[model samples]
Target: MSSQAAAIAPSELLEAARVSKAWPFEEARKIVSRLEKEGGVSRTVLFETGYGPSGLPHIGTFGEVARTTMVRRAFELLMPGVETRLICFSDDMDGMRKIPDNVPDRAFLEPYLHMPLTRVPDPFTNEYPSFGDHNNAMLRRFLDTFGFEYEFASATEYYKSGRFDPILRRVAERYDDIMAIMLPTLGPERRATYSPFLPISPKTGRVLYVPMKKVNAADATITFDDEDGEETTLPVTGGHVKLQWKPDFGARWAALGVDFEMFGKDHGPNMGVYDRICAALGGRPPEHFVYELFLDEKGEKISKSKGNGLTIDEWLAYAPSESLALYMFLRPRQAKKLYFDVIPRAVDEYYQHLAAYPRQDVKERLGNPVWHIHGGNPPAIVLPVSFALLLNLVSASHAHDKAVLWGFILRHVPGVTPQTHPELDRLAGYAIRYFEDFVKPAKVFRAPDEVEAEALQALSVKLGTLPAGADGETIQNALLDVARGIERYQDHAKTSPEGGPGVSVAFFQMIYQVLLGQERGPRFGSFAALYGIDNTRELIARALAGGDLSEV
Candidate 1:
C-alpha cells in the first residue's frame, strides 16, 4: 500500500462508492483505478448531507450524519494532512408540516403552511423563532455532543446571502428536465410542486428571476395579487437551495462542490436521475449511495412525520453514542431493515469485535490477515465505549471494580470508557445531564417491591455471612465462589440437555434471586469474577442494608 493510502475500517464503502454500480463494470473499474492512482490523496474534500427541519430529528436523520463523519475520519487517517469537512445542511427552506408533539408551538406557524421553513416557529421554546434556526440549533447541539465537526445550516445564511441562486436558476432553467426526473417517481399531486427547482410563484403567474449558473440571492421578489386585486409583496425571503427532487440534486451537488453524500433507499429512483444529471451538468455527481432505514422495535420504519420515533436523546438514555455508531456501521448500508430489537446484539457484537481485534504480537508477526478485511485497515474505534469498557476492566485494580452497581456506574465508569463508547456514555451521561439541563426534580431511586425484596434476602442468607470489616477484595472472591457454584450446576445441565442429577435452570435462577436481591442480576460468575469477590459482596450488603436494591 502507498504510504498515502491510510488504513481505514474494514469496510468496502469507499471502494464501492468509487465504482459506480449504475455504470458499466469496465468503466467503473477504470474510474476507480484512475482515482486511486492519480488522486493519490484527497484534498479538501467536502461531504454534504441535508437534514430537514419539518419535525424532531429522528435516529435515521442522525444516522446519515454519523455515517458521513465516519467516512471523513477515514479519509483524514488514510491521506495524512488531508482536510475533510462534513457540512450538515438543515433544509429549513422546506415548508413545515404539522407541529411535532414535543416541538414548541409558535403562533406564527399557522399562516405559513406553504411558506418556507424560515417562517415556521421554534419547535423547542414555542417562541416566534424561525424553524430553520430551531432545527439547526438542535442538530448542532446533538452533533457537538458527539464530537462531530460540521459547518451547520444549509438554508439560513446560504439563502440569506443568495449563494444558492445560480444553483436554483440552473434548476429552474432545467425545470422540464428536472420535472421529468421527479414526476416519474412521484404521485400525481406531488408532481405539481415537486420540482423544487421551478421558481413559479403560487401567489401569481410570474416566473422568479433565478440565476442560471449561480445561486439566486438578488432582490427577485414575488408579488401576490389577491382575488379582489389587492397586491402584496412578501419579500420572497428565504428559498432553500433545494434541488428539484431528483436530477437537480445532481446540479446542486456540482454547484455546491459536494464530493460525497448518503441518502436512504426510499430515494433510489431519485438517485438514478442524479447520476444522469451529473453526466449532463458537467459536474461529477457526489457519490450518492443508498443506506437502509432504521426501524423501531415494532418493525415499522421510523418516521418523524407520523409523530412516531425515538430521538437521539432517547437512544442516548440506553446506550453510548459509540455503540450507536458501531450499530450503524456494522451493517452494509445497503441492507434493507435495521431494527432496534438487535441493539443488544449490536452492543455485545461490538465488544466481541473489539475483543477479537488483533491484540497479540505473535499474531501480528505471523501476518494474520484477519485485520486486513476492511481494505487492510482495522475498523475505527467508532464506539469509544468499546475501548473504554475493555480498558477499564483490563486495567482495573480489582475485578470488583468491574461489577460496580448501576448507582456507581455513572461516577466510576472510567472517563476513558465513556469517551470510547460515546453512544453508551451518552445514555449514562443523559440521566445525569437531563436532570442538570432540564432542572427536573431529583427522581428518588427506589428499590424493588416486596417479592423482589424477599428473593434478595433469601439469596444473601445462602451466600453465607462475611466477617465484619472484610475488605472489598475478599468479599468479591466469596461472591465469585458462590457464583461459580451456581455456574457449576449450570454446566452440568447444559451438557446433559435433559433431566440430570444437577441443578435445574429454575433452581439456578433461585440462587441468583438470593445473591443479588433481584429476580435477575448481572451474570453471576462474570460479574463477581470481574468485580472481585469481596467488592461484590460488600456492594450487595450495602444494597441489602439500604433496603432499596432495585431490579435493573
Candidate 2:
C-alpha cells in the first residue's frame, strides 16, 4: 500500500526476489510471467477480492482482502511503475436466498426473500436504504480502518448504470453455449430449469428463476414466464438480468480485466466453470490462488451465516490487528482452527518477527511475514517480553490494572514506559483480558501427585538456594537440574513408554498445572525471571499449600 519500491529495491534484493522462497514472491512471479506472455503490463493490472453482501462482512472477509493485498504488494515491488488497481467487488444485486439468523426484524425480511439484496430493507438502522448497503458500508469501514488501498465496486451500481451492458449483451448472444457448459454440473431437477440470465420480475420486483421461454439474441432480451404465467420480455442489458453466481464470477473477470484473484479451497471445484464462462465470453481468466479454509472449534468450516466461529470483533477485543494479519499470512494453504487459543501465540510471533527484522539480511527479511505485513518496512516495535511471559506475569502477580502490571514491567525493563512503549501497554491490557476470559474460566488446578510434589519441593528448595539476583537462564538451569535429579522421575524418564513424552516436557507440564493452574505455560526460566525468583518461590509455596495461584 505504501510506495517504497524505488528506495528499497536494490540489485541484490531484485536478484534474490527472482528466486526468493517467499510465497508472495512466488505468486508475483506467476503474475509477471502471465503478463509478459500477454501484453507486458502496458495496461493497469487489476487485482480483485470478491464478497457477497448477504450478511455483515466477517473475519474471513478481512483475511481475503489482507492476503490479496500481500500479493498485490509483491507485484508492485517486482514491476515498479506498472500501474495497479485493486477492486473489492460486492455482489449486492444477488437475490436474498433466505433471511439471516443474525439480523434484527427477521419477520420483515420474509417478504423480501428472493428479492435482490440491494432492494431488501435494512433490518438494523435506517442509515442505509437496504441491508446490502449497510453491510457494504461495514466492509469499507474495516478495510479503511486497516488503511487498505482499494476501490469498492457494487454489482447493483454496475448493473443499473449499464457498466456491464456490453458483457451482458455478449452473454445473451452466447446464452445457449454458456448453458451447455453449466447444465451437466447440475441434476435433472436443476438442469430442467437453468438459464444463464435471471430476469428481474417487472410485476413482483423479485429475481425470477423460471426458464426462459424464448431468447431473442438480436434484441439482447429474454422472454420469460412471469410469476403470474404471463410471457414477458426484458433486455438482458441494464439491471433487468443478472447472471448466476458461477457465471457472474467469470463475467465479472471478463468485464473488469482482472489479472489476479484468490479464494478458499471450497471454490477449487468450480474453477473450471468460472474459467470456461470467462473464456467463452471473450476474456482471459485471472491467476487463481486457493488456500485452505478455516475451521471452527469443532472442525467444521466457519460459516458467516451460522456465526459458529470467531468474529473479527472478538479477535480485536483481545489482540491487535497486526497479529491477525500475521495469522492470515502464515501457512495460508494449510487449514487452521480460527479460535481464541490462537491469539496469544499470534501476538507473540508477530512481535518476534518484528524484533528480528532489523538484524536480518534482505533475503531473510523478504521471507519474513512482517516484511509483507508492512510492505517491506516493518515498524521497530520491540516488545521487551513475550505475550506468554506477560500473561504469566499477570497470572502470578494478580495484576488487575495497568498500574500494577507496569510496576512489574518497569522493574524488568527499567527505561520502558507506557508513553514510549504503547504497544507494550496495550499488550498488558490484552493479557489481562485474555487471562480473565479464557485462561481463568478453563483453568483446572489439581494437587500435584507424589512424584510431582517431590519435584516441586526440590525446585522450591533450589530456588531458595539461588542468590537474590539470579538471572532467568540461571534459575532455569537450576530448575532443570532439580527435575533431572529426582529419583522417582529419573527412573521413569529412563524406562518410560517408547512413544511417551520426554521427562522434561512432563516436568514442565506438571509445574504449569500445579503452580499456574494451566496445563501449559511460557518458558519457565523467562517467566521466573519476569516474576522475580523470590516471588516464584512464593508461587510454589502457594501451590503446595493448595491455594489457587491462578487467581488474579
Candidate 3:
C-alpha cells in the first residue's frame, strides 16, 4: 500500500522537501549547494542574525529571529545529516550613545552616556548587573518561549575573551584599505577625525571616538590623543579597542565563518562596503538578503525611538505566537504594517491554514502555513470557527466568561468540549481580550435609515414566525427571501437607488451595526441560527422599537 501511494504521488513529492519553492527553502538550497561544491556537508554551516541591544526587544526583533529560524529549519530538512548552527549575536558592547525614550527610568541612564551598554546600570533595577544584560535576558526569555534553538553570543564576551583578537589584528593590518572603503562615505568634517579603531578611555571608561595618531600593526597597538591632549597607547587586540560599525560587521562575519545573514533594506548601501572590507581582508562575505522594514498603521516606519508599534508582549497577549509566525512567513520582503488591527485577520488565517491542513495531500500540505508553523509536524485538530467569528459572538452575546463563550462554541462543533479543544479554548480567551482592547472601544452604533428600518422590521416579524428549532439553511433561505421582499417593496414604492443589490447589502450592514455594533460580521443567517433565532429576533425587535440595543 505504501508503495502504491508513492507511485501515484504528485510530482512535487519527487522534489526536495516539497516546499523548495518557498523563499527560505530556496535560499537554504542555494546555501547547501554552495557548501557541497566548496567542501561538502562535513563542515558545519553557520547562520547568524545580529541584534543591537540598544532597547528592549520588540516584535521586529522577534520577526528577524523567527524568520531566520524558519530558514534554518528549511536547511535542516534539505540536508538531514548536515550540521548547522543558528547564532543570535548581540552587539551589547556598543556605546549607549543616547538613552531610548521608550526605556524606563530615562533619568538614571543620563549619566552613563557614551559608556558601553553592558557597563551601564540596569534602569529597570531587575538586578541583571547592567542594562544590556537585562535586555538580553528579555530577548532570551521570549525566544525560549517560542522554543527557538539558538546559541547566543555577546559582543562584550567575544571582545573581552580575546576571541575577536584575530579579526581585530586583521582590521589593524588592513586599516588603510578599510579606511579607503569607509572615508568616501562620510563628510569631510567626520573624515578628518574618523578612525577604524575606537579606543575605550582607560581613565573615564567612556568609548572614545578620537582620531588614531599612529598604528603599529606589527605590535597590534594603536595610539590616540586623550581628552586632555595626552597621548595614550592600547593593544588593539583585546577589549581595549573596538572597530567601527562597518569594519566590525565585516570582521565578525569573517571570524564567525558565517554562511548566511540578512538585514533590512535600509542597509543596502552598507552591504557593498562591508563585502568589500571582508574581501580586502581575504575573507568572503556571507550569502546576504535584504528584507524590507515593518511599518506602523499609518504606513510610517516602525521605529524603536518613536515607540510607535506593537511590542512583542502586546502581540502575544492578543493573539497566539503562531499567528505572528504566519505574519512573518508571508512576503517578508514587502513592507507591511504591524499593529493591533492586523492581529484578528492573522489569527483567522492561522486557523484557516490549520483547518485545511488535514484534508490536503502531501504536496498541498507542504505549501500550507501550518507545515512551516509546526516544522512539518502539524497537529491533528480542527478549529470550529474563526477567531473573528468568536469575537463577534463574544460581542453580541456579551460573554464575559469563557464557559459562556464555550457554550456557543460547543453548539457549533458538537461533541468537542473544552478538553477536546484546548487550542480553541485558548483562542477564545484571545478573542475576548482582543475584543475588549480593540473592538469594543471603537464601536459606534448607527441607526438604520427609514427604508432599512422598515425592511428590518419585516425581517424581524418573519424571524418570529420561524419554528423554534429552525435549521441554519432554513434560516438562511428565510433571510434571503426577506431581502428579495424588500427589493420588491422598493420597486412597488418606486424608491430611488433602485432597491437592487445595494438594498440587501445595506440591510445586512444595518443588522451588523445595530446588533454587533460593527460594519460587518459573521454570515447573518448562520450567526442568527447559532446565536438562537429567538434571541436574534428579540435584538431586531429592540432595534425596530428604537430601544437600547447595547444589552444584546
Candidate 4:
C-alpha cells in the first residue's frame, strides 16, 4: 500500500529561508559527518556558554540552549546512533558587581565581593541555600520544563573531578609566556604569580589563588597563599574552580574536549583570547556560533543592572512553550537583537509551519512516490495572521461547544481534518488561561472600569428588554453576533476607507460593546454557524439580562 494513500494533506514550505539553498544546512551536515567519522569525541557533547550572576533566566538564555538542541536534532537525523549532550554551565564563579532589586538586604551580600559566585548568598533565601543554588535551580527548572538534558554546574563539579589540574599545570608550564600575552591588556604591573584559574573561596572575599607549582594533575591538589602571606595546601573540593576568561578556554578544550560553543558578538575579543590559549595549551579551540541579545516589549535591551528584563515564568503565562521555542529557533544563533513583539506572530507562524514540515522520516529508507509526496517535500498551509485570527475566533466560542464549531470549520476548510490535536488542546488551554489571567469579566468596552449603569442602560435601549431570555447559549450567540459584525465592519472599513457608515456593521459592533464591551471580535456569522445561533444568542442575553449595557 502507498504511504500517500494513508497520508494526511500536505503542508507548505516553512519560509524562504528554510527552503533557501544558501542556508548552512550542508555545512552543518559536514560537521556532523566529520565528527562521526572521528569516533572518539562524542557527537553528543555540545558546550553551552554558562550564565552566572544573571538572576532569573531570560529567553536569550533559553535561545542558546534551544538552538544547540536544534543542531543536535539535525545531527541525530543525519547520523542515527548519535546521542546529544547539552552541557549547561553556570559561570557562578565570576565576580558579582550589583545586587538585584529583589534581594532583601544588599549589605549581607557585600561580604562575598571579588570572590567566585558560589560564595554569594542564596537569592531565593536560606531555605534554598546559596545564591548559586537558587539561580542555578531556577535555570534548571526552566530548561527541564523546556525538555533540555545533561545539565552540569560549573560551581561544584570541575575541581572534585580533577578537571582543572591539567589546565593548571599547563598554565604553570607556560606561566611566563601566558603572563606575557596577558600583560598588554592586564597591565605590566599585574602580579605574575597568578595562574589562569581562580576558584572561589567560600570563607574569604578574594578568590583562592592556587599556586601553579603545587598543582598536581594526578593528585588533584594545589597550594595557595593565605592572607598572612604563608602558603597553605588544600584539596580541590568544588566545581566553582576558575576559568581564565579567554585563555582557559583552551584549557576547557583540553580538559572537557568540548566540540561546540555559542556566544555573543560582545565576547568576540574573549573568543580570540581563548583561541590563543588553546594553541598554547596544544588544544583546538571549540567550534562556535555567536548569537545576539533579546529585548523587552518596549524595545529596550534587557539588562540585569538596569533592572529591566522578563523571566521565563512571566512569558510562559502568555506564550506557549513550543511557540517560545520556535521564536528562538527562527533566528541565526549569531549577534542580533531579538525583539519581543516578534513573539505573538512567531507563535502563530511556527504552529502553522510545523504542520508544513515533514512529520515522518522516510526519504532515507524508502524510494517511492508515496515518500515523495508525503515525506520528502514540505507542506503548504495557511498564513500565521490568518491562523491567529481564526484561533481567536474559535476561542471566542465557549470551550464546551468546540465540537459543533469544528464541524463548521471542516465545512469551509475541506482538506483540514479536525483531529483531536494536542496543539488544539494547548490552544484551548491558552484561551482559558489568557482569559483568567488578563481578561476582566466586567470590563465595559476596552476600558477596565467602564460604568455598569451605562452598559445596562445601553442594553435596555437597544434590545428593548432588561435582559434576554436566558444567560445560556442563546445570549452568548447574540453577543458573538455583535462582536463578529463589529470586526467585519472595521476590517471592511479599513480595507475600503472611503466606504460610508456601515449600519449593519455599526449595529453588530455596538451590540458587542453593549454586552461584551469590546469594539471588535470573533465572527458572528461563522460563530453562529459553528456554535449554533441559539447558543450564541443565549450568552449575550445572559450577559445583558435586565442589565444596562450603558452601565456595564
Instruction: Name the best candidate (by lDDT).
Output: 2
Superposition error at 38 for model 1 (Å):
7.4
The RMSD (Cα, Å) of candidate 3 is: 3.9
lDDT string, candidate 4, 436-502, tens digits? 4444353464321234334333433433331423322444444433333333334433333235333
Q: What TM-score fits each model?
A: 0.62, 0.95, 0.92, 0.65
Q: Global CA lDDT of candidate 4, please?
A: 0.53
lDDT of 2 at 543: 80
How much is 512 displaced in model 4, in angstroms? 10
Model 3: per-residue Cα lDDT at residue 295: 90
lDDT of 3 by residue, 320-418 (tens): 999999998889899999999999999988878877776777666656777777777666656766787788878888787788888876665568787
**Candidate 2 ranges with C-alpha deviation above 4 Å:** 1-9, 491-503, 550-552
What's the ranking of the predictions by TM-score, best on top?
A: 2, 3, 4, 1
Clashing residue pair totals per candidate (backbone < 3 A): 46, 0, 0, 56
Shift of residue 245 alpha carbon in model 2, Å = 0.6
RMSD of each: 9.2, 3.1, 3.9, 8.7
lDDT of 1 at 242: 39
lDDT of 1 by residue, 284-357 (tens): 76665577777665667877765455677766764556557666664535453444334444555655554455
Q: Provide the lDDT at 225 for model 1.
A: 40
Name the runs in model 3 displaced over 4 angstroms.
1-19, 465-474, 487-504
Query: Can you write out model 2's per-residue Cα lDDT over 466-550, one digit (the tens) per residue?
Result: 8866778898878767866665545344543344322457788888888877888878988987788788888888888878666
